[model samples]
Target: MRILMGIFVLAIYGGITFYLGWNLRTWLLAIQQFRWPIAYWIGLYAISFGYFIGKLHPLLTPFSIVGSYWMFFLQYGLILCVIANLLIAFTPLTTKLVGTWVISVLIVLLIVGTYFAYSPVIRNATIEIDKPGEDMRVVVASDFHLGVLSGKGHLEKFVQLSNEKNPDLVLLPGDIVDDSPKRFINKGMGDVMQQLQATYGVYGVPGNHEYYGNEMKQFREAMEKANVQILMDETILVGERFYLTGREDLTNKNRLPLSKLKPEDNALPWFVMNHTPNDLDEPANLGVDFHVSGHTHKGQMWPNHLITERIFELDYGQRGKNDMHALVSSGFGFWGPPTRIGSRSELWVIDIQFAK
Candidate 1:
């Protein structure tokens, strides 16, 4: 199975490299950057190799961080080039002109996209739930994906934003760290994590990427050192007013479901932390007061949000009926592009009232 997966990945990577190179072939030839065809081939191959590095981004560290931006440019640039060539399929205009236009536009978009990626805006939302008690302000955010590229600066900003909200409880759904939790510790994010001030404390779940590189041990250790509690299919009472149940991330098939993990004491307000928003019916059916999640990133980039829209009913916001409500965060941090074109990077400041 692993071998088959590897082959599948290789095939896709190869196809993308071939298509991008062919689409930009004329531009490559016209450029004096490479005096010889051999050098040109080397350069193209190096760029093409960026895709693989991106796939293994969690482990590649600082190099992958820089490579991620380039990969995004290459990805979009190729698509634009393909579209231009198709639009002018048989036109007499030289392909060079189309290529130049596409390249120029790609550069401009890259700058704009970078700015968008770094500047994540805070989103404020309020949802009401039954199970009477005192009002509570819960801050829920996820998909930080902090690693080589999305690093210290991003972490500092996120922590600051989360703290400034002054949420009673800070809930991290998943994908908190990218490559390795150790990276967070080594990169000073561990200290930042400790600075996240919440009366009820900060809680987290493990996302797929946390397990991607067999870094669960490191992840657990980081959480402990940072004073963040990781709840793997566990439930705990917070503030003696509500129950916070954090389920294992969707990545684990053996993970316990909401039915088993949710505290049977239905008197207290319940908040469920789930990484992926899929299977929302389960949480709703279980009578959860609020289900918080973040893996979707609301597609993160243009047209990508559309794909997520088709997949999740509550892809990027709040929705519920009666006693059950779900809040899906686009994410506090980001992945690949570090830019938010179609979607905004976000932290959800949830003002919760416990009135009957």
Candidate 2:
């Protein structure tokens, strides 16, 4: 079944690529006859399949990066192509005119999205927990996805922005490393992360990407060495005030449940970080005062967020039920392509006021 599904998906992807290439050929032919049909098809398909081809080996990372951008183009390009085709069919508009407009609009969208992806925004929220503690400024940044595309420069910006907030607690929900932590460790990104200034400490949990890499020991060691703690299905009391419970990414079926991972001192305000915000009721039912997560990337692109909004209850931003406040970040890094449409890279500076 899985093999069949994979084949079906590949077929659909190939069909789309072919359609897009054919339209491009038609558009170019309208302007002037092109002779390199074989080269054109080869380049089109190669760029389309760059990501998967590059994924087969680490040496082809440049191909992977180029392919990742193509994936985004494929997504929006398909939509624009369809719309342009429809306009050409229904209206008196010529293919050249419609195609010109479509390509121009697509280019603008990609440029804007790339701009938003690189520009990180700080989102703020305040929650008053009915627990005794000093006012805490917690900075939550998730989904850094530090790999070939999002390099150490992005981490430096994150550290700089996070330090400016002067957060009491720095909580990274997940996806700190992309598919593998190789580039992150090899490039010394962890050292940049260590510069994050938080009064309490910096803590994070594993995202599905971490499992994808299957290098938990290396990822954890790198993080710990940088003073960024990776909590795996465990609860810890910080400053003897609040309790932080970081659950293993849902990818791990053997991970402990929210009930089992409760802090020894449950009376303190309990904060839970589960990489994917699939199960909110579990923590809410367990009386967790705050729940933070990432993984949706808020769809990470235009109209993609619409799908994520349906899958998760609170896909992005803060929500509340009684005293429990939950926040799901859009994340600080891009996953595949460094493009963000209808969403911007964001980190939350949550101001927590504990009850007197």
Candidate 3:
């Protein structure tokens, strides 16, 4: 049954891609005219091979499985070609077509460069808990994807940024690495973890990407090496003031629970950390004080932020009532293509103050 559903979903995704390609046929043709014939042919063949490899191993690569990354590059190249041809075909007086292309390329480079350079800055915010006379300050970041793209330097920057925050407790909601941490054992992430310093300690939950390759075990081991606490269907007390709970992803129900976890005392301030922001009602009903999460990445690019807003109640900021606030961070790292168009990668600095 699962296989059948997966196949059906893939079929729909493929249809969409094909439709998009068909719509850009004229643009593709025009671009092809400007491209070196051999290079164009080789690029096409490589893209086709990536698609086949992705389909054969969906669990190993979700980006390839959904054809999203490929589609982005393919469509982006086609769009550039189309725009260039339009400019040339129109023969506009100010045609600096080459200049325009150069500018566009530079803009993309600038965006990517800025995202990496400033990615280490930890963003801060404050949240007010409903309880009286008690307060907690929490630091939250998500989607580090710390493998090939992030590497050791990026991890070092992250640790440095996080340390500067001086958070009472740190929350890593998920996607700490792009691949199995074991794959990068000698890459110095362990050393980076050793440098991690938080007053209340660091807690992490698994994201869908971790489950995508069944790499949760490797991820947990990596976190442990860094002295991070992995919270899977469990709750803990911090400073005799708040209850911290972490849950497994919604899709992995067999490995964890889908329902809300109850605290031993109903009056204590409680914080719940989960990957996706779905199932708010469960926590709300349980009187969870705040829910911190970051799977949306605010679409990680332009126009897609709108899509994320529609899909999630709290897509990239604070929402819900004073009793139960749901805060979602845009994320600290990029997922694919290494670009963030409309949304900047962010970290949440939440100050939880109990009312007096």
Using lDDT as the measure, the top candidate is 2
lDDT of 1 at 318: 87
Winner on lDDT (2 vs 3)? 2
For candidate 2, report its TM-score. 0.98
Instruction: Output candidate 1 Cα RMSD.
Output: 2.4
Error of 1 at 103 (Å): 1.1
lDDT of each: 0.80, 0.90, 0.70
Give the per-residue lDDT of model 2 (tens digit) for 164-266.
Answer: 9899999999999987888888999878988889899999999999999899999998899889999998998888788899999989999998899877675
lDDT for each residue of candidate 3 in 149-244, tens digit (9 for 90 to 100): 556876676677777877788899987776566544668677777776777788999888778757677778878888889898888897777788
**Total backbone clashes of model 3?**
6
- In model 2, the worst 10-residue window by lDDT is 261-270
Cα displacement (Å) at residue 152, model 2: 0.9
lDDT of candidate 1 over 31-127, digit per residue (tens): 6342576776666666666635555545544445455665776668767977887867878766677778888988787777777778888888777
TM-score of candidate 3 against the unseen true structure: 0.79
User: TM-score of the candidate numbered 1?
Assistant: 0.92
Runs of candidate 2 exceeding 4 Å displacement: none
